[model samples]
Target: MSVINKMLQDLEQRQPAQVTASNNSKVPAAASRRSPMYIGMVLLLLLVLLVGFWFSKNQQLQAEPANATNPDAAVRAEPRQPAPKQSEQHSTDQAAPAAIIAALDTTNTAANALSESTTASAVAAPAENAAVNLAAIITAEPAKPTEPTAPAPLVVVAAEEAALSAVARPQASVDKQPLSVAARQHNMQLRANASEAAGDTSAAIVIWQQIVALQPAEAEGYLNLARLWLKQQQIVTASQVLLQARQNGVVNAEINMQLAQLAVRQGQWQQALEFLSDQFELAAEPEYFGFKATVLQQLEQHAAALGWYQRLQQLQPEQGRWSLGAAVASEQLGQPLQAHQYYLHAWQYRQALSVSSHNFIQQRLKATEP
Candidate 1:
């Protein structure tokens, strides 16, 4: 009975010890499970940090190569701080794991602050690098040179004018050549005509003299000069000019007719007949025939005057003056019957005669009746 009671007491004390031991064993098991979960979280955090660091480093490396390739970009880039020494980098890497561990061991709020700080640093570092690269690229480009200004409008116009003047100088000089003989004579003739029209007889005479001097063979110049001299009642000058024209071998009919008229005006009837005799080719002309008939009558050459007046009467049958002239010439030559016939013919055209001529013809018809 004593042995059985002692065993029961020991079992009771052992049972209490066993319960405390089991409780101790359960605490170790819970602690072990929680440790593995904490280790996985720590490992995940470390992986994230390593990935962030690697991405930032990759961006930095890319930027460095680009900057090296372009000297201008490198020059424009913000001056970079010197790279850390190998030992310093190594020490920093070693300290990073310790800092992460410390953050994990701290309160949750402290760990969260550490994570936010790390994230902000990672984001800011890339942004700063990108800003630096953009600045370098923008500043490295070359500045464009300014364009040259154009010449002023006034200056360009002046240069053009100068060029045109240079081209035209020779042409203007060419146009200044002397006029030809015919052209000069024609211009002088026009000036003479203008002076004559303006009643400037002396100026017209001077111009005509210049024309005659220029071309002495031109009959028109001598004729115009003689006409102007006669207008001023310069009979001797006109006769001299006409005689000079004849001496110069001018065969003008007007010259002979003008000399005949001048001799008749001076009462030199025989001289008028002699002067008219040179133009025998003008026998067909009524003015020449009539003037020759009148000169023969004045010189008392009745037979010659009768022939000319009868020929003139035939040529101009409607003229009463020609019939009267024929009658006078026939009466002078003692042909009374022919004179009476011409007087009757003259009376037939009485309306063509002047009042004085009609009275004379009436008296001649009565006196010369057949």
Candidate 2:
């Protein structure tokens, strides 16, 4: 039939839907009275008719091979404008959008034909040929000279290490390592001693830690291991090492003192004070009193902290204004008179320093201020 006749038939078919909507009571009465509304409806009917005619024309149009015209440019049908929401999203997510849609629409029916192939014979020919042709074409095209992937080097596991893993490992027992393990450990200790003689504390530390790992029962290993960890500023690890040393019946007060020092550094006042209680004074070190005062203050033994500070002042009058710390601590401990006296003593020490020391004193004085 003629194009105009086909368009009119399609338009007549769609007119029933518009007629149904117009007859619905929910549509305003004023809609029926408006000429523009009828005109708009007619225009919509015309547009649909035009689309139907264009579709019919396209169906009748001659088909050709894709590569016939411009070999690189695939021949495709003109695309219709997308519906509003689809158009908005498509515009945002695409550039050169019309061409993409055109290409897609043109490929649609060929893809549809492949999906519509129902017969077993039809399926076998296309599916097998398509896959095989793709692979063959790829293989026949060219070989690219890609960089060779290097073979991984084989790892050679030593016999002793292999045998160790082959046996079921038991839980590490505390107190004593096996004698053979101790011999191996003694080798490392001697190695570290030699490395230290060679002036390599870093290498000595690594060797010592390895020895501790292999034979944790040796008290000397634990002690030296703790010392190495302490030098590394790993306070908690050092404390744990010394605790394990105690399990080995380590009787040295110095080891406990080191553990206490690490504990106090981490503000564990109870642990620090407990360790210190068992300690004997080998010499009257000023730092021992200072550390004792620190532990007392942290443990809320403020009066004790102040007394230690006062003892420090009496023993060393030449020392910087430690009386400031005493004043603050005593005041916080509710000794107002003692606080006033210590603050005055702090002031007396302040006048004795030079310009550089004067600034230092000013800072300490500010700290002592009420």
Candidate 3:
């Protein structure tokens, strides 16, 4: 019982101490909050007063110019001489009242003052933002003349006029041939190559046509133009180019080969056969021979195809395609004995044949064996 009474006494003593301590802390906190509120209100009032003062000053400044009763005094007050040397220093000196009035009477001082005031007021903003705002205000300021400078010299004016006249007239005296025909051809070829590299096939085609027109006797230009036409799948246009090239007497083996390939693309086997026949000796390549044999077989000219297949076989004896081609041609020509002999040779040299082709040749051999 004694211990519990002592404990109650201790609790009573600590409660008064805690209450006094809490009250002391609350007093300072309340005072601190009130002080900040008072400071904020005072700052707001100061801002309001500053804004009103600025507005009233601006109005006074504006009215002072209009209310001038004596026009002569206003004229006398204005500086007649243009001070071009002072323009750079005017921005800094414009803060002074006398300098502001003096510069305003002669130049744009009010805008500079406004810009300066805005930059000063925006000090609390970020440095970059402040700089940007200042730049914007300066840019918005009106551009004023530095001075009424002297007029241009007569010699300068004459030179400018002469230059303009020279430009207006064609410069025939600069060079008799600014660009030779050969130079123009080279430039056109470069443009064509650039267009092709950029995948602009139509542009390449147009440039190639220009090259052909520039050099009708140049077989390479005609051949290039024809290839561009073929790339666009314009088979008729390609064929027309070939005919034009032939009429122009631009005889070239490459041009003939291009025509043959173009005719094959258009499925004009007879035209292809004619083109190949003209250039066959010069272009006796294995691919050309195979191409010729295919075209001849498409036209059902088995006898001509048989000769091409024979030539291909001579060129590439181990290739099964030539043997197969010769076998098919002999069968079409109604010579079974020769057909059977060629088919047997094809079976022996059938390394390049696909599985389906192997099956086909086996079936053909069985049919022709009797």
Candidate 4:
């Protein structure tokens, strides 16, 4: 190569390189003379890039957990709060919940407590949980189940039915007979009564008629014979014999009661009322109202019957049976509203009686009531 050619190539390369350096130096000088606003923009861009890098690094640190195990845990498990003192515990100010809501809340609380306790125990004792299977768990849980408390024991009683029976011990009852005038007369009377009871009313009449003729002053014989005939459904004969006996002597009130019952049986209501005029001497009592009302009913005087029953009830307000009986009679007479009022009164008395008595009469009255 010629010395001149080599020098010329080298000069060309050096000139190009020196021109690039001069250009770069001019660019720096131009940049130094830039506006303050443009410089501030560049600085803002640098700050944004640095802030982005810092935020990314913080996110990575937050994702990483302090403890490797139990990553979802919020904090270290703290000891449970101790039971509050009675005074320290606050009473709820709200009104009591409705029965249904109270029951649901109680059930939910119990279920939640049971579930939480089971989870806590499982976490606390892993080896024990593995050792104890379903059978063991069931057996252990039975000792302290979170089931709702049982309701108070039911209070009910079976009421025993009361026994009702009548025992007879009449002083007039005699098994043996004696051979005497009085005994013979009694035997004859007894035979007549037996005949009447056996449906042989005509034979009984004949025996009584003979006895009356034999002893005209014997009022008892005549009256007893009249009663026997009455019992035999011989109403006419009974009335005639009783009329004859009335002249024998003034009979006692007990005999009059018998005559009254006989008259009522024969549908002679007015006569019966008259016969019972002297009944006060035998037995004067409020219970007689029942008999009076019954007589009135038989006489087809339903209103009077109702009045008598009402009077009895008014006299003894606690007599639920009588009150109900009166109500029934009123209803039969087509007085529905009046009967209902009476029934209501009866129910009131029955309630009072139920509270007062160990042996309630309401059950008996219920069967007989309207």
Candidate 5:
């Protein structure tokens, strides 16, 4: 029995060994079945990873051109990896593609923003250059000259007349050609005379000065200017105007007569005689003979005075002044008979004489009776 128990123990040990082998073989078959599932899971994980990598590559390819222009875009385009958890590997695998897609979207957005900024800068650069060029062109051009404004009318005209007078004074002697007075000057002269008639001496003086400035070589303007000046008691200014007239080659009989009259007023007999000398053509004028006769009588040259008076009487037969002048000079030269004949001739026109002269002539006629 002991021997049988030993064999049985041996069989039990054999049985345990067979069971161990079966369990080991079954474990292998089950492992084989689970292996395909793990393989499939691994293949799916690999596919997901490949797709994520492809999307990352695609996003990189798209971002390359933008990164070339903007270096900051390259930094923004790099993919970021999250820290993986051992328990959440499947969950991590599923989220990887989504993250990759999100990164691609971010990279695309950055590239688009970079491209838009570059375009804006390009457009703004040209606009700024155009503005700068316009400013430079405006700066390089020459400035236009402004036209001179006209001066005021009346005051400036008066100043111009004064300047013309000053300039014309030195040239008066050399310019002998008589300047023709314009019709405008003549019209101005008429206005001046009208002002004088209206008792506006100041206005008349201003107009006459303008007329003289217009026609410096004309004797009439100088004469009128002198007359107005003398009327204002400006004797020196009147004399200066007459001298200026002579300097302008105005040696006419009227100018000489006015100068002689002025000299006579100043009690300058020699100067007056020299002004009315024979150098001037004074023969045809009856007044010239009369003035010379009076000047000769003042010098006590009774014979010369008598000759001039007789010549004046022949020229004006019925005038009482000529007859009376001849009578005075003849009586001074001691010819009583000729004097009596002249006194009777003057008595016929006694109404022309003043009251004192008529009384003197009546007494002389009674005294020198024939």
Candidate 6:
């Protein structure tokens, strides 16, 4: 019984030691599993912390620009200017081109009106302020150049008016010779007219003489100078100047008529007839025909005299003298019947004839009727 007991005790002690050893081995395996789990948990916590910090920093960075822009946006908005929309900016950009296109299309009146309105607005708003504010939105426009509100001083207004008148007045009275001969002549004429208006007849005469010197072929200058001489009662001087003008190929009807009158005064009837004959078609005066008829009748040219008398009567239909002259011419041409008819017509307009003409016409009418 003692031996059996000793062996059992020994077995029991060995069993206990073996069990403790197994427990120690199991503890090492469990420690390995627990360490891997702890490492994974710590790595997960670090990744979560890093992700949260990165997210917070990114949010702060994004919010800073917005916070900074707020005050600037408020300031920009204070001017009552609406922020330009993308669509409106594009429309404004197109407005200038549209105005140019409308201006080019002259046939389209409505388009032209629209273009005018658009141009006015563009000039007032965008074109004027474009250099100042690139982001400005176009709106209503001003129409014309701005005028000063307060009335200017009378002296200042008068000065401005005088300046304007000076600018607007013709520069013809200046003594400066223009490059063009025609311009010089015109200026000289204006100067002469001014001198004449100022009662400086001698100055006018001198200027006209200069004009005649510059343009010897110009008839008006000679005529003006001759008329000035005539106005001064210098008939001899007028006659010489007119003759010079005629020799210079300045043969106007008025100059010829003056020459004819002077010749008549000097009793050069033939020379007067020569002057008047050349101007018959050119002149439309009653005295020219009358003078021609009187000269022809005095020279015993009854046939030619009759035609002139007829023309004078046609021109002066209300006068009775031409009828009596026509009757006398017809009687000399041996047409007593025609003379009697003209004599009757002359008697009907006896008031237009002198008393001596009326008595002569009545005696001619009585003799022709018999």
Task: Compare the candidates by TM-score and give the number of the best one.
Answer: 1
Error of 3 at 339 (Å): 2.6
Leading candidate by lDDT? 1
Residue 121 in model 4: lDDT:
43
TM-score of 1: 0.56
Which scores greater on lDDT, model 2 or model 6? 6
lDDT per residue for candidate 4 within 1-370, as digits (tens), equals 1422443354455546645865877745553333233334323333433343354345334323322333322122111112252123122101111221232223335545544654454454444323433333333333343656443332221121111111222323453455786777788889887987898978987887777776777777677777777667787877777766666665655456566777776678888867655245212455555666777777678887888787778777787766776876877887766776776777776754445331333443444445
Lowest lDDT 10-residue stretch of candidate 1: 1-10
* Per-residue lDDT of candidate 5, residues 94-210 (tens digit): 554443233322333554554465456446645654553454334322232356566566778999999999999979966877555676887898899899999999899899889
Ranking by TM-score: 1, 5, 3, 6, 2, 4
- The whole-model lDDT of each prediction reads 0.74, 0.59, 0.67, 0.55, 0.68, 0.67
- In candidate 2, stretches whose alpha carbon ends up further than 4 angstroms from where it belongs are 1-202, 206-224, 231-236, 248-254, 265-267, 344-370
lDDT of 2: 0.59
How well does candidate 1 score on lDDT at residue 215? 95
The residue-level lDDT of candidate 5 at 336 comes to 88
Per-candidate TM-scores read 0.56, 0.36, 0.45, 0.32, 0.48, 0.42
TM-score of 6: 0.42
RMSD of 1: 20.0
**Candidate 4 backbone clash number:** 0
Q: Over all chains combined, what TM-score does candidate 4 have?
A: 0.32
- How many clashing residue pairs appear in each of the predictions shown? 0, 0, 0, 0, 0, 0
Model 1 over residues 200-238: C-alpha lDDT tens digits? 999999999999999988789888998998999998889
Candidate 2 pairs with clashing backbones: none
Candidate 5 residues lying further than 4 Å off, grouped into runs, are 1-181, 279-284
lDDT of 6 by residue, 72-103 (tens): 53344334333354346446434433333333
Model 6 scores what on Cα lDDT? 0.67
Candidate 5 CA-lDDT value: 0.68
How well does candidate 5 score on lDDT at residue 236?
Answer: 80
